[model samples]
Target: MRKLITDRRLLFGYILAHLFIFFTFEQEKVFWYIFTATMLILISYSILDETEQRESRKFHLFIGILSGALLYGVFWIGDILIDLLKLPLSNQITALFKLFSPELTWHYLVLFLIIVPGEEIFWRGFIQKKLLTHTNPWTSIVLSTLLYASVQIHSGEFVLILAGLTGGFVWGILYAWKRSIRLVIISHLVFDLLLFWLFPLR
Candidate 1:
């Protein structure tokens, strides 16, 4: 574990990948998809060991649904806060909606099939797990959440940053306690569907 975290090559690769994602945010949607897929593959094979294949014993459908609901509730509060504050990110989000004027079905496909799952796989499955090697559990969770939020802040939207912060914190805690990649992925999917599609805050 110590050797893995301290390896200069892995550290450089990780930083490079994040910088790539930060710059690729405004690129074409196809580029976004490809980048995510590439990152997922790299992160999975590079850091994840055989232990990751063993699913979490704590996962349950009922708990996942409840957790999803609670996460969505956070977005609801975030929505109100954005409105009350009149954050400039509101305009950026609204612009984002226009920029990606895909059919509703395609939009849902992107969110569910690619973005949500890809993010969970990389962030929670890979990054958080890697962090655990060097830090205490709570520290791992908090650091991973901050890293997750940093990517969103590149959007130049405070509200988007807030959403990322809230979601990352919730998912980080869930993964730490439940230790379930499946559970965190499902909750993430639910949160994305609700916040971006069914009940967009902007």
Candidate 2:
């Protein structure tokens, strides 16, 4: 159990935490609070690990920012594709925005900074790393993507799960090749920011 809780296992815990919040709390505000708190915890853990590893903190931070922008670009491209295809998935995304409407100023802050950072730490840094321990690179990628999608399951979230799986695969590949949590984090943040900005909850 102790071995399991190593950064990798903690990431699984983070996913579970989000799933819990999504199902248990009906209010968007409550979910945001839970999300913010979880992100802080994950960030603290990442800082401690980086310190122990004796890596350049500044470098990792830079990677995080750059990766996020790149990922956002990827997301934009995907959005364009979806538009061209005229897929029903776009409607689902729009519905999600409506469900979370009247988002507070602080919510954006938490979403961009804390939530994105925390998720990057867990999925890219922890889960992917852990998966690599017992599996081949490609296997780990698939498993991580599936797990990522599975973790997002909830009522009225089928489209989200599909998107999660697709994004997870891309992010997992980037994380595997670059071994940079920053890249995955940046991609995720950009993807989400665009989604929210363009769609927003009605």
Candidate 3:
């Protein structure tokens, strides 16, 4: 824990993420602008930090698409359970969707082209992979997931934080296994497409 906190590069990345995400959520009117800027910053950092497998590989796209669909099913089941249990999360979830969901065509373009890839590359490919050297793969995954979830704290929506945890865990494991940014990026993009556009929970 101390080592992780002391690690300059990791610490820098975390601070950057938290700072930008905080700003991203704080300004609702210019949320998209801040969000886009945050992703760009992370993408720049990731490319400079390490050399990841960015090339397309065999079964990567296929597996990414399938895994994304499977993750969507997991969330779908969770949504059903939440409704069945009468959880007080629907409004929070709805609000988060309203804030983050792409309503314009350009929003979708930025989401698919910039946001998803930037997130996967930085969180799973860079941060999680960097954590691997300090601890076991599982520990790295969980820690990265926690860090990812923590960044969403400023959103003031429990559901969004939970989504960060859940999605981060899946992508963490995928990157640990595949070591392919392309794969995780595709998977994340597919998941976002389904959750935000094709079939939103709310």
Candidate 4:
């Protein structure tokens, strides 16, 4: 339906972008370069749109920090549970990325800044906002979380997928509670920075 597509345009766009990256690029470095560039462009657009909407900057920043902490806590807990369970599939998924070198570390930094912010805007700011237009806050949160989790299925990492869903839900709630994209972006950036720095793959 036109209405559904209109509401979920950002989500659709993000998925399309990933598909292109997956098929068109064979080299990881090249794929990441294109992906990061795309993310930077999307994030810039989201920021400008927020400014034009005359949203409260201070409120978004405040909520961003709080939501970031909450999401980080959720991710931390999920990671611990995964470890305790010692799920074979999850551990194997993690093992695939165990050879992270310095180059990959630098690439991750770029991903943290660009890809994560872009995804936050698409999933939290755009998709969640659209869902709220037709659904209740809780419904929108859950739908957005599910969609977010779906995106991670390609990662082949169950633990990471679970964390993404939890983080997405928290961001959705925060956005609904405060109605600010800035906060979501701030929180997302902080959470990602910590994750990348503290737990560098390899």
Off by over 4 Å in 1: 1-13, 28-55, 100-104
Ranking by TM-score: 3, 1, 4, 2
Write down the worst ten-residue block by lDDT for model 3. Answer: 50-59
Q: Residue 127 error for model 2, in Å?
A: 1.1
TM-score to native of every candidate shown: 0.80, 0.70, 0.92, 0.73
Which candidate model has the greater TM-score, 2 or 3? 3
For every model in order, what is the number of clashing pairs? 0, 6, 0, 0
- For each candidate, C-alpha RMSD in Å? 3.2, 4.7, 2.1, 4.0
Model 4 ranges with Cα > 4 A deviation: 5-18, 21-31, 38-56, 96-109, 199-202
Candidate 2 lDDT over 33-55, as tens digits, reads 76677567655654454322221
Pairwise lDDT winner, candidates 1 and 3: 3
Query: Please, what are the lDDT tens digits per residue for candidate 4 over residues 1-202?
Result: 3465564455555576566444423444465666676666655644443322233455566667666766667656665666789857556546535522224766877766667778878777666776776677898889888887775665556755776777888888877777777788788877766665655333
Over 61-120, each residue of candidate 1 has an lDDT whose tens digit, in order, gives 666677888889976876577678997666776776565434457656766776677777
Better of 2 and 4 by lDDT: 2
Question: Best lDDT goes to which candidate?
Answer: 3
lDDT winner between candidates 2 and 3: 3
Pick by lDDT: 1 or 4, better one: 1
